[model samples]
Target: MDIVVFFVASGCAIASAIAVVAQKNPFVSALALLANLASLAALMLLLEAQFVAAAQIIVYAGAVMVMFLFVIAYVGPRGEIGGGVRKPWLVALSVFAALLIAVEVIVVVFGASLGAVASVDTDYGSPAAIGKALVTDYLLAFEVVSVILFMAAVAGVVFGTGGRPVRLSTEQVLAKEGESAVARRREASRAALDAARDSTTGESAR
Candidate 1:
């Protein structure tokens, strides 16, 4: 039963990973990533790392994926490229990747040693143990990750602005609208004057 569940989760993870890369739509890719994360969580659960599995689901599949979807929504999904294969380099890269995968498979099948599974303590992957390690041994790494996340949020906001002002005052918006209206009216009057002049010239010629 464990073997069956592991295979199923592994297959789902592989499929979802492929879908995440193959799909051109960012939104669909994000959904595939969520599926992949969920599959990974299942694998973690099978390993008896319940805390890790729950964190994977809550932090990655839930919170991170929600943020990804929101960003995709805000940026708007991009249309697929409308041309034939443009990059000749990608063909070579794909071939190289295929060969690498083949080598890995061969190594796993014959070159790998069959070793006994290692044993772990009952609390090895528990939340308590992880929390203790985080606060004691890995506190610097934890704080660093937090700072990196804060920086990433700041960077996202900056890039999303796309050189535009983040906020506009009501008066500024009204002024810009008024200027646009004036420009449109001016353009219309100029077009009308040109049409009238052309008609007058035609009449004189006749």
Candidate 2:
């Protein structure tokens, strides 16, 4: 059963990851990534790491993927197929390096005697234990992440409002005023010409 679960989870993860890269549409790619993340969470659950699996689903597959979708919706759909692929060599090198790392991880896992590893106690799931660890070990890092999230939210609001500039430089202000004055003068000249033409037509008729 364990072997079957592992194989099924692994296949799902790999298939979804491939779909994410292969899909041309950004929304499809995002959905594929979400599937990959969910499959990963399942794999973690199979490994008996329930806490980590829940965190993965909630934080990454839920929140982060939703955020990505929101951004995609805000940006609207792509109109053009992107330019030709560039730097194929760099991409190949990256894939090669990732394969090498995967090989190393597999070798280390299988080569090491599984019996030598200490058994993990499942007591780490307690709320008190988690709170203590977060407060004692990761408090500063957690606070920093919160601060960053707050800053990002504030920046999104400020930049997303889509308004005209509140402050203009002297040259910009002068240029705008000059353009307005020129437009007004042109309108006045056009009005005067129309009035003169009308008067001339009336005199000729008389």
Candidate 3:
């Protein structure tokens, strides 16, 4: 049963990871990443790391993915790129990546014996022990992560608005609305001119 579940999770994870890269749009890539994270959580469950699995789902699949989706929503969809398979830079990058992969595979094939290096304690992967380690030993790292997240949020707000000022007052908001109204009026005038020209042409023909 565990084997089956592991295989399923692994397959899903692999497929979703591929989808994350193969997707051209940021929103679709984020969805793929969410699926990959969920499958990884399932894999952690199969490994009997219940706490890790729970954290993976709650922290990564839930919180992190929510952030990803928020950013994607704010950015909107990516514009389409026009280029044939003849993109030189992409071809070069692919060849370089393939060569790197081949070298890594060669090294792994000729690597030392894969033996158990050390025995893990019974409760090594338990939630309680990990929590203790995080608070005691890894407190600095935890705080650093928090600070980084705060900075990212600040940066997102700055960049997401494209440096536009937030129109909090009614006058400013109305001015922006007026600009849009002017654009709409211009479009309407152009459309009306085209319709009148067509009518005049038809009348003359008749």
Candidate maximizing lDDT: 1
TM-score pick, better of 1 and 3: 1
Candidate 3 lDDT, 1-206, residue by residue in tens: 88899888999999999898777777788899989989998888766678898898898878888987886776564432521365789889998999899899989977957786566667867899889988999999999999998999999788776967764564565576776766686799999999999999999999
The numbered model that scores best in TM-score is: 1
Clashing pairs in 1: none
Please report, in order, the local distance difference test score of every candidate based on alpha carbons: 0.88, 0.83, 0.83
In candidate 3, where is summed lDDT lowest over 10 consecutive residues? Answer: 77-86
> How much lDDT does candidate 1 score?
0.88
| Residue 13 lDDT (model 3) | 96
Give each model a TM-score: 0.72, 0.66, 0.66
In TM-score terms, candidate 3 sits at 0.66
Clash count list over all predictions: 0, 0, 0
- Indicate whether candidate 1 or candidate 2 has the larger lDDT: 1
Q: What are the RMSDs of all candidates, in order?
A: 8.0, 9.5, 6.4
Candidate 1 residues lying further than 4 Å off, grouped into runs, are 77-84, 105-114, 165-206
Give candidate 1's TM-score. Answer: 0.72
Question: What does the lDDT come to for candidate 2?
Answer: 0.83
